[model samples]
Target: MVVYEGSEEQTNRIFRALADPTRRDIVRRTVSGEASVSELAAAYDMSFAAVQKHVAVLEAAGLVAKEQRGRERIVRGRPEVLRHVHAVLDELELLWRTRMQQLDDLFAQEAEADAATRPHDGTPPPPVP
Candidate 1:
């Protein structure tokens, strides 16, 4: 397993927050531009309070920022946090790729060893030591 730069709790919160489809959509929308709580709620079929809860989850994950612009609660994506998330994902990818390469090398070594032991002609195989 790859150890990420952030704390385990924070990572868990981030993953848990993003696991929801509604929360993911909120992040995507806010990342592109700022949106008010009411505006976001209008786009979805759920009640405004439900959308607020989704936004709250994203906020707790540090994926988005919420600010009060008069009566409206403005929500915007945090690029820096997203960058950190991207880095974590990159690390995971690197770890998996490295593991895959190691597996490939092991397979190649096994194939070479098998080739060495097998008789080219129709003779019996070599006895194990």
Candidate 2:
């Protein structure tokens, strides 16, 4: 199982919003710049209402911001949330590197023990061709 090291509540909301492909698509589309609801709706096969709902989920997660225009709502992707996600992943990476170093040390110790058990005097093993 994979563990996430992020704010339990906030990360839960972020992940929930990202779980849907349509919502993820909406995010991708807005990365270039903010787009109106009708403009975003045209990019996907889903109904405009469905795309609006996806935008709502992203806004709730603070992954996107929606501004009220005269008629349409403009949705923009918030990249800062993704930077937070990257930071959490970096923390997990540090934990994994520490674990890997410990495993490497254990393997080296086992190799030394095997060499100690070799026949004849305790001399270094000949280099392999």
Candidate 3:
């Protein structure tokens, strides 16, 4: 599916950032509201630096943003990016749905043709020409 917004590199970064389970969780957590990097690190077993790296990756993807609030780095989810992702997925779903409908219509037409060629008396149909 085609995304109307952002360059290919930006889209690739977004998808790459989301490919990780930890990153996805981070997005989910931050999306609800803002959270400190330390607070996020606390939720995971990994080191604080690891969490920071994840946040950096997310920041690079434009999926999340971090701001310094005094001594804490508060991370907030970019709802707009999430909305864009949803829109892209919706477009893909629509494309697939349309294709499936076309296939169904084609199959129905074939079925109708097959039925028309069958003998009403239940005898075997004629061989292919």
What lDDT would each prediction earn against the true structure? 0.91, 0.84, 0.95
Q: Order of all candidates by lDDT, from best down to worst?
A: 3, 1, 2
User: Candidate 3: how large is its RMSD?
Assistant: 1.8
Candidate 1, 1-129: lDDT as tens digits? 445566889888998998999999999999999999999999999999999999999999999999999999999998877777777889989999999999999999999999898999989887899
**What are the runs in model 1 whose C-alpha is more than 4 Å off?**
1-6, 122-129
Top-scoring candidate (lDDT): 3
Error of 3 at 47 (Å): 1.0
RMSD of each: 2.8, 5.7, 1.8
Instruction: Identify the runs in model 2 with alpha carbons over 4 angstroms from their true place.
Output: 1-7, 120-129
Q: Between which residue pairs do clashes occur in model 1?
A: none
Q: What digit string (tens of lDDT, one per residue) describes model 2 on residues 1-129?
A: 234454578787997898898888888888778899999999888898888888988998888999999988999998888777667778889999999999999999999997776756757767669
lDDT at 79, model 2: 89
Model 1, CA-based lDDT: 0.91
What TM-score goes with each of the models?
A: 0.88, 0.78, 0.91
- The top-ranked prediction according to TM-score is 3
Clashes of each: 0, 0, 0
